[model samples]
Target chain A: MTTTEARPSKLTPRGRATRERIIQAAAELIYEHGVQNTNNERIRLAAGVSGSQLTRHFPTKESLVRAVIAWRADTVIALHKIPQLGHLDTFASLRLWADSYIEREELCRGGCSYGSLAGEALKAAPSLRPDVADGFERWEDLFRAGLTAMRERGDLRPQADPDQLTHLLMAAFQGGMLLNQAADDVAPLRDALDAALAHVESFATHPVPHDDATGGEAP
Target chain B: MTTTEARPSKLTPRGRATRERIIQAAAELIYEHGVQNTNNERIRLAAGVSGSQLTRHFPTKESLVRAVIAWRADTVIALHKIPQLGHLDTFASLRLWADSYIEREELCRGGCSYGSLAGEALKAAPSLRPDVADGFERWEDLFRAGLTAMRERGDLRPQADPDQLTHLLMAAFQGGMLLNQAADDVAPLRDALDAALAHVESFATHPVPHDDATGGEAP
Candidate 1:
């Protein structure tokens, strides 16, 4: 419920740019050092803003973190909007997505901000919950849109539930990233994606029976 | 690489109980606050030990975290040894695991301690990479063993590679956790597990035919 309510920019046009640069630095610091470990002073030093300036702009650490979460959500969720996914093979698109994920990993250095923040905030700050929670919901929508597009193009089984598949795909991708962090390697991500891609491809060769009952299928 | 090297309680039995209490307190604090964020002073306060007494028992934070990780490894990994997993229906066993995971989320409120430490450590300290990496490798191995045993029992696709499936499963689980954290809900984990269990069931029902390049219909 807390927010940066200040409507006025603290600095001039050039000063505004400086403010953004400082915010970016603070975000990076937050990503690198745990938010609790990172403080206004460290953020100021890292961002090259005066301690007074940092406080004037951010006022509180929560506001600073919220800004970062918004930015990250925008970038991570941008994948679904890239046109021409309609033409790409599912595996090709997934590989591209994987490569992009690698870029994100490098940028953050071993952890997704969402995962880290969610864990940290869950235990400490109850306020940040809404932002993180909302981000995931949006993420699911992004995937659902993409899968729906594929279904419309006949790349997916006619009876396939795009919404359900979206959940599954995102789940695996998220899990893969977590596993990659744990193993401190990317092989798990690759293996998981490869297995998933193969299954999607196999769906082309052998479709689930159209008349198959939902509940009584093999347990 | 820094070890705490606390002396085993050579003191009265009462002293041993106190030491254990102190260690447990430190673990909770470290999990709540980042390892670096938590200090001996705070730990002493939480544990009700004198600052000097806390220092006498455990000299460093790294050593305390190490102790927790070591203890967790022994206890949590032992959970993987449940036999006859292959004999259980995929749905039944998966539901059990999934439910346990949800329960964990409820308990931690934030996520997982092992995951949190790995994320924080890998980001801030490069030296801890080895410990974090080794720990996850152990986790992956446990998963691999389960998949392997199940495959041996004909509970998996004939050509399913246990290692590959293990990776996929791990990825899904981790990814789901991330999504769970982001959404502040259990849907991601639940949805992903549902897909995985469904995929296995779908796959087991239709094994791919062996190639007969010799122009003979081989049974």
Candidate 2:
């Protein structure tokens, strides 16, 4: 379904607020209990909206789930603030970005929000795969833009591929989070990011001095 | 729950066969449709076993899920045949191992079987986290053993940390497969693995000749 169909153009300010409230409630419920277990009734109660209101905003559960996917994508990008930072062209900024993700207590505990939603969507609602895929593509694009900037600025080798590197970084982050979820530890996440960053560092046009790079004492 | 508790000691040959059939059926069901969607009745029907027989083997759904996790771990190792090939000491063997996983059609379609189950189990059955973690630990150990062999054989640098590298490899794999599932494409999986392999290659004591390594014509 298209965005216009899912969200009618006739919404007043109050109607928009109500819709946002419902979507927020549904997103949290789905995050905690998964898509299969979270029903419209539960969402309605959680949102403090009536069944009719819920139905008015979302014609079907699929539409609501799609809305949640879209909402989550926006929320994730906002939370990352990568777009706000503009370009992650320098190695230090890249390291900072990686560290910011690693240091998040919520990620260590609950795993990546996008990944959790995507995982459940893949299983319970196969039809929504495109929406989930769109979310990931958007997220990857943010990184790809930064990496592209690096390549153009000559911080990366002339032949270094920003697109491929973006995929590698995203995979490492997603995979590390998955492992973290399974192991109930953050070490896997840390190690995975470290390895990916090292790989990226290998492509630096002028490698950072070892001591400056690692912050380690002189050998 | 402990293994001994999950699987009772006393069972005749027929009873054992029934149990195996039930687990195999449950595993397939879980693979095709996640843990939340696959019910005991469906598994029983698929296995062609009576309700009583199913209950006798796995009194609880949790027990059966655990059995599936155990079965999946074993099946994944056997399928890889890495242990049978002994050490992945040489870079060529490592490349072969990575290629074998990438070339699998089932992986392209269904994603990594073990990863799909783990993803579902993480969301649907939080208590089964330990079982999933144990399965991953076992899988990582297989890779760690190979890396350790490479280091001991002087193919890798003396200071190379097998444990950390194993984490990176496993993270890339799980992450790559997760991306593959979301994108419905194998390129992400390939890119992730290629990046991880390149990272691993950086540790080689005597780097494979560029021409011999990549099989590309001379520059």
| DockQ of each candidate, alpha-carbon based | 0.36, 0.66
Give the true-structure RMSD of model 1: 8.4
In the range B1-219, model 2's lDDT, one tens digit per residue, is 543333545787888888889999999988877888899789999999999888878888888998899999999877656553555666776767777777774765666789888877777778899999999998888788889999898888876778778888888888888888889888788888888888888888885754355321122
What interface RMSD, in Å and to 1 decimal, does model 2 have?
1.8
Residue-level lDDT of model 2, residues A34-76, one tens digit each, is 7778898899999999998998888788888888999999998
TM of each candidate vs. truth: 0.79, 0.92
Q: Each prediction's Cα lDDT score? A: 0.62, 0.80
Residue-level lDDT of model 1, residues A50-134, one tens digit each, is 8777766767778777666766667666755576343233545654555566545553345665566555554455677787777
TM-score, model 2 to reference: 0.92
Fnat per model, in the order given? Answer: 0.64, 0.70
Identify the candidate with maximal TM-score: 2
lDDT of 2 at B202: 88
lDDT of 2: 0.80
